[model samples]
Target: MKKIFVLDTNVLLHDPQAIFAFDDNEVIIPAVVLEEIDSKKRLADELGRNARSVSRLLDKMRGEGQLHEGIPLPKGGVLKVELNHKSFIRLQEMFGDVTNDNRILAVALNYRLEQEDLAASGTVTAAREVILVSKDVLVRIKADVLGVQAQDYLSDRIIMSSDIYSGYVTLFVHPAVIDEFYTYRYLAVEALQLPVQLNPNEFVILRDEMGSSKSALLRVSMDGGKLEPLYLSNDAVWGITARNAQQRMALELLLNDDIPLVTLNGKAGTGKTLLALAAGLMKVEDEHKYKKLLIARPVVPMGKDIGYLPGEKDEKLRPWMQPIYDNLEFLFDTKKSGDIDKILMGLGSIQVEALTYIRGRSIPGQFIIIDEAQNLTKHEVKTIVSRVGEGSKIVLMGDPEQIDHPYLDSISNGLTHIVERFKGESISGHMTLEKGERSKLAQLAADLL
Candidate 1:
């Protein structure tokens, strides 16, 4: 039973290649959707990039056949534009206005009605079922009220926007066990001794029965952290280096070229982004493991909006990227702000870009960092990830608990979605950092909050 998918303008704006994502299913792009895309084509951001890509894709399909009627897609699907006037009439009667979103909804509702009529006939049709797919939650709810089957486009990534792991934990181990490990340097365990919910790369602070002189560290190997790795280096991102046991494990995971996708989730002020940036810089800039260090992050406003600042693009981006700059300054030990700016200028090979311009371009052979990923929608995150070309490593870092998007909660953010989706994947890995190394005040606030 092949279904007819009526795509909303937001879906296309969220992902330009969304038409091809529904394999073998008939995709209907309402005329209103095209109009909306055209309207957004002039914006200089992700939305504009998607709009332009959609235009180029449709233009290329025009050479094959008529899009108004129907065209065969290379991926074995039918692409067509819905130009029915009845949809407008029905929309005007029901909603009283031809707003872009409502018009798109009308197109979907009209198609659904047509599908029912065709279903009554004895002849089977290619589109017996109609599915209105959009990223807007309210739109989907409205479609349900109109007696139409509507769904959110979720083909890009897995994991709900919430339920992402935070890297800190207080583990309860026996007093004798804690004392034994502190004295022996390694704890020999035969079975799973810790909590079942512990994720890889998570830090655990073991407390005695009396809760005193406990150790804080990372769990290097599976099976209750018994199999700790030998540490080779103490030089780490922050002043606090990964303990001998944690250092070896970090190096193993960081240097593995086979594992291209890595995620680090922690509270604000934790060394999640700094550690990832440090590891990336070390690998790409110091070790030459990658060709370039390409850093990007969502331009989400933290706290009150700064409005628009005056300057060139880079200068404008500097305010939003101040956190990134802080990390760079700390890593390079630039005592003065002017010296840090000079270093950033001198490091021509390192590209710090905004996530807005990543669409439609394929990036390969680079270490990409997507900071503050929790702000991105699942569709937006997919658009960024799909642009990864061959031989590229992508890392997503964010604090899921500190999401700022009005539509997205902790369960619907991109960071949580990526973590949940890639959990079982062998080539991908994730860690939740618990210790807030930024400062005592920051850590206290995170804990209290």
Candidate 2:
């Protein structure tokens, strides 16, 4: 049966292409949603960009026909603006308010009643299902209380956290295979002839199938034709050594110039940021592989924002970039208070940027790191990654389960989306650090609290 989907303002803001996602089902936009989108079109952020994109799309579609009467979507469904359904009599009795959310609910409620009336009077064979689509939890609950079917938009969600790719797998092989890998330093993938294909640059632990203690830690070749040894398997970068097998794998990918994109995800105290910073410094200062080290992160606050911070751009970003500075300080071993600033000034190649100013700029011949990427949306991530010019490597690291964005969750955030999307590509590699090396107390808190 053909369904009718009423869109909330947040659904469009989260993903502007949501109109075409319903597959031939009628899509309705409440007039109140337009008001809300218009109010956000002037801000200089991702939300403003999305609001403008949606407005332009709707304006372009207006050439086809009147929106209120209904217009034909490129898909085989009708798109309409709900202008005449402002009645709130049914809602005033249950919840007396005329807020934008209530107004949107009124539009959906009116549509459901109209469909039912038509079906009962024999004007239609049956009533089409009316579903209110939103990204807000409270709105969905209120909709349920009003007897309206509410659903979350799931077009961009990739997978649950438990099902995410860990980037490393244990493979049981014959004792001789492990011995050959150890002796020759490489083993052909054809020798395994396994059931499933391995992704390029995937880490593998080949254990002896005979239950012997012999094991070899190797990484798959970019071409997936052979298993090769980790180049920096035992090397320390910027005075930081890998404390675990997963951390070693992370460093292997991070220090490799062949791979252009790397993603790392783990709980707090897992050394994700620390390892990334170490490798970045090594690439920029030691190897001179890249011209500079550029680090940027989404500015989503953990709790209520302090609001309108004083000082220049760098000072304003100090609070958010403190974690980055802490890692850099540890790597440089700065004891004095002003030592980090002097070291950064002497290097002349390290730059810290807010993600807000990253758009419309092409970054080339640099090592870019985006931390706390879980707060970003799919569109925002694409925008940032697309700005990577030639000879540049980008690393995105964040714990998917620790997202701070109001509209994004573990499955729908940009970090997890990119991890799943890029896992199969030869130019990209990922690792999920399991153990926490920050401190015993910190690890315990992460696991328990």
Any runs in candidate 1 off by more than 4 Å, and if so which? 73-77, 117-127, 158-238, 241-262, 269-308, 311-315, 324-370, 375-396, 400-429, 434-449
All candidates: CA RMSD in angstroms? 7.2, 2.4
Model 1 RMSD vs true structure: 7.2
Write down the lDDT that model 2 would get: 0.90
- Top TM-score model: 2
* lDDT by residue (tens digit), candidate 1, 1-449: 77789999887876678898888889999898888899979876556777899999899989988899899877788999988757668667776876887877888888887777776773555437788998788888878877778987777644444444443356677787766765766654455365545544444556665757765444434333463433335565434366334333444455567768887777887677677777788878778888888888877732223347887778878877888888888888889867877886787757888776666799999999989998887767788888988999998888878887754566667778777876645566676666677789999999997
In the range 1-449, model 2's lDDT, one tens digit per residue, is: 99999999999988888999988999999998999999989876778888999999999999999999988877799999988654588788888876899889888888888899999999999999999999999889989988889999998777865788889999898899888888999988887897667899999998888999999999999999999998874767889999999999999999999999999999999999999999999999999999999998877842223359998878888888899999889999989887998899898999987887788799999999999998888878899999999999999999888888888998998889999999889999999999999999989988999
- Candidate 1 residue 367 C-alpha distance from true site, Å: 9.7
Give the lowest summed-lDDT range of ten residues in model 1: 243-252
Q: What is the C-alpha lDDT of each candidate?
A: 0.73, 0.90
For each candidate in turn, the TM-score is 0.62, 0.93
Candidate 2 runs further than 4 Å off: 160-162, 301-307
Clashing pairs in 2: none
